[model samples]
Target: MSADLTHVDTWLFDLDNTLYPVESGFMKQAEARMTQFVAKTTGLPMDEAYELQKTYFRDYGLTLHGLMEHHGVDPDEYHAIFHDISLDALAHDTDLLAALQRLPGRRLIFTNADDRHAERVLERLGLSALFDDVFHIGSFGFLPKPDPAAFDRMVEAHGMAPAATAFFEDSERNLEPAAGLGMTTVLVGAHAQDSHASFVHHRTDKLAPFLATARLKEAA
Candidate 1:
């Protein structure tokens, strides 16, 4: 079905891969820290930690969740160690800033990462001022995206009408809950899937260009 792309009063965007280009290498550094932490904490080899991390991320909403449940790892420590990386490689995108400004609505960030991490990235990318608020994983008691409970909590807390909101995310699984709630789900990233299996309502590799048509397209 062709998306109507109208009546979006709230623009919810995911951090990390959604707000910034996935190829920025920030996530690569974070993932490396995660692997290293997992290996050190679980007494596993680096290769084993790598596979386990992926499995945990697949099975749980996030790798940190799995580590907490299975290994009793503290979420705070996980965030501190993994999210402490430098963002020297991330470049500010003026087009994205302009596009975001053009999109008429209350722009908010919905991220699985912690508050500090989200702040760091947004600060580095020069996009921190664009968002009104950022609801991080900690706000939902460490539960990440794709969890209906977390979504419901956020919706209720913000008094957000799911039908009038548009959520842009990089992970296909994360979009499922938003779509289920009648929110328009836009898959963002270079490798975003347009498969029928996905619940995504739209797909865009370039966020700035896609958002450039935001008001006009939705106003149609």
Candidate 2:
């Protein structure tokens, strides 16, 4: 917000941890499901499955991508199992909702998650109607973020000018590609300060308050 974001006309947000606080335990549920899928598919023990899941995430940016590349897992099957998470721990974030409503211009979700998961998460957070579009993993043909190609596809598909866009993400690595494409990159979550990466234009442990500080552009 203090970084001269007045030129931003398109807001691209990552779902999951970016929208809801990680402390909410919602992602823990999805991660547990991911471990279960890995165990059942690969016949690995629960403990080892958890480790492999983490490795896949570390290497591929998405566990599903690693599974598809190494195990030939079907994308649809993986998505269905991995995202069948309970939202009991997620509370409605009225502050985030208000901030998004205040921001003028196109608002879109750019997530590694599939559309179904994205929609459900937004609906749970009372932000379902606020977004103009969702560019999910399917939209990128299973290529997820941190990959420069994914950023290019999103920009091309949405007809957005990277310089006029601002992307918010929870992962510091993911913001690197956005910055490379000339977009304003804001890192959200507890580890935001841990990153000394020059690519991160802004950092905030709390997204709603950071967004609240955003200055609107005046009419020409």
| Global CA lDDT computed for model 2 | 0.89
For model 1, residues 1-220, the per-residue Cα lDDT tens digits are 3345568888899998888888887788888999999999999999999999999999987999999999999888889995658788789899998888866668899999999999998999898888999999999988888889999989987889898899998888899999999999898988775545457888888788887765444431
> Local distance difference test, per candidate?
0.86, 0.89
Best candidate according to TM-score: 2
lDDT of 2 by residue, 1-220 (tens): 2556788889999998999988898888888889999999999999999999999899989999999999999999988875667778877888988888878789999999998998888888889899999999999989878888999999999999999899999999999999999999999999898889999999999998888777866431
Clashes of each: 0, 0
Residue-level error in angstroms, candidate 1, position 171: 0.6
- In TM-score terms, candidate 2 sits at 0.95
